[model samples]
Target: MRAARYLRLGEAYISAARGVLAAPDFEQVRLPFYGLLGHGMELALKSVAARTGWDDERLMWLGHDLDWAWRVTLSDAGFEVHGARAVGGVIRQLSRPHHAQAFRYPALLTWPLPDPRCALAAAEAYLTLVRDRHG
Candidate 1:
């Protein structure tokens, strides 16, 4: 299924971001790392929509709207939100008041970001839950 493929890609992106975390020049790539994570999560939610028989056009409409995609995913019966809090928090932190774009482009705002390790773990947990339940 496309969802499964997207899920795999999502994990790959998150994994790639995590690898960058261990690098000595973390600050240099910090922005890109957040972008990667946001993208990975976006794919996760879009992939879930794909699983629900939504076409590419519908998924495309979702764009980078993580909150909307997440809402759609949660509409599924028994989404098994084992680590929903963390993922939800990250989504909130990324989607509301600002957007994933901030991570990709320079912004005049400054705000605390979620810990990379914890964010990675939460992402993995969320993906695992989705895979186990629907992948």
Candidate 2:
């Protein structure tokens, strides 16, 4: 259920993050963060599942819109990860030694925009929130 929650949040965040990126000023940059959010969700899902022992199929059965749920959660948390490089960077950031223990949703408010590195940071917050509340 926790994993499902994160996935849903991730899906929702990606859409809003993309909207921010596509805003008049950011339109020129056109970073395309939705893809990055999806990638981040995929990576986070796999990683969290592997670590938590929730198989892919089991997670799939959690809900049909889990991806959307993840997106919404991330958006509510204010994470704005977008792009492949940004996604990778975020994952790396989250993978760092302290993230699993220290990252939090408020961190997203200060989270740098247009940086893929923030994806992992977002993931850490999502996972931590779910784990803390449900685990």
Candidate 3:
């Protein structure tokens, strides 16, 4: 039940991110866009982790570390996450020390932001894979 809820929340966050990314002036909103994308992917990874027998406490402890979640989820299946390189890149970008804070605050982001559409597509693919394998 908790896993299901996490998955649903992940989907919702992705959906909201997609909507924001679809706006005309998305360049002006890069912070929220990437922040939401990173967070959504984190939740999606947590959902996969939960399906692989992670407890709620463990998920919370893992908190906001998309790289760890990604590794754990892929390792649980003993395979690479297919069709998600763009999303993976974004996760790597967000997982750097204090990167989330830098993104949330007004710091100069030196890293290139992935195209929202491409990132979202890869994220959706990952979520679909998780659903198919775990559901």
Candidate 4:
């Protein structure tokens, strides 16, 4: 299923980010790390939508809007996800056009990137919440 595919891909991106962070020239790869992180979050949100019975068209409607997807998933699930508020805040920050756009193209945006470790923690927490609730 698409949800499973997204979840797996998200996990892979998180792993890739970790690998980059462990390398000697970590500074050079900051953009790629955040890019992977943002993409992972996007995929994770889509996975949630799929879990909620959204078809492919509805999933595509979600597009790269993490904030909207996060809100809709939480509302539809009707449960408080651990670290959801904090993660949602990250999602909102990343959802801004420039920030999200940065993931795809070179941009001169100056927004602060969330700490990779903290971001991973939040993602894992949120993913766990989704699994516990849906699986």
Task: Estimate every model's Cα lDDT from 0 to 1.
Answer: 0.76, 0.44, 0.75, 0.74
lDDT of 3: 0.75
Please report how far candidate 2 places residue 44 from its true position, in Å.
Answer: 4.0
Off by over 4 Å in 4: 97-99
Candidate ordering by lDDT (highest first): 1, 3, 4, 2
lDDT of 1 by residue, 13-114 (tens): 888888888879998888778778878888887777788787888888888877777877788533548768888888766564235477766775476778
User: Which residue segments of model 3 deviate by more than 4 Å?
Assistant: 77-80, 84-86, 97-99
- For model 2 the local lDDT of residue 65 reads 36
lDDT tens string, model 3, 13-132? 888888988899988986787777777788888887787788989889887777887777778746466666766776776666223565578877777666667777877887787777
Q: Rank the candidates by TM-score, best first.
A: 1, 4, 3, 2
Candidate 1 residues lying further than 4 Å off, grouped into runs, are 76-78, 96-100
Best by lDDT: 1
Error of 2 at 52 (Å): 2.8
Name the lDDT of candidate 4.
Answer: 0.74
Better of 2 and 3 by lDDT: 3
Query: For model 2, how big is the CA root-mean-square deviation?
Result: 13.1
RMSD of each: 2.0, 13.1, 2.1, 1.9
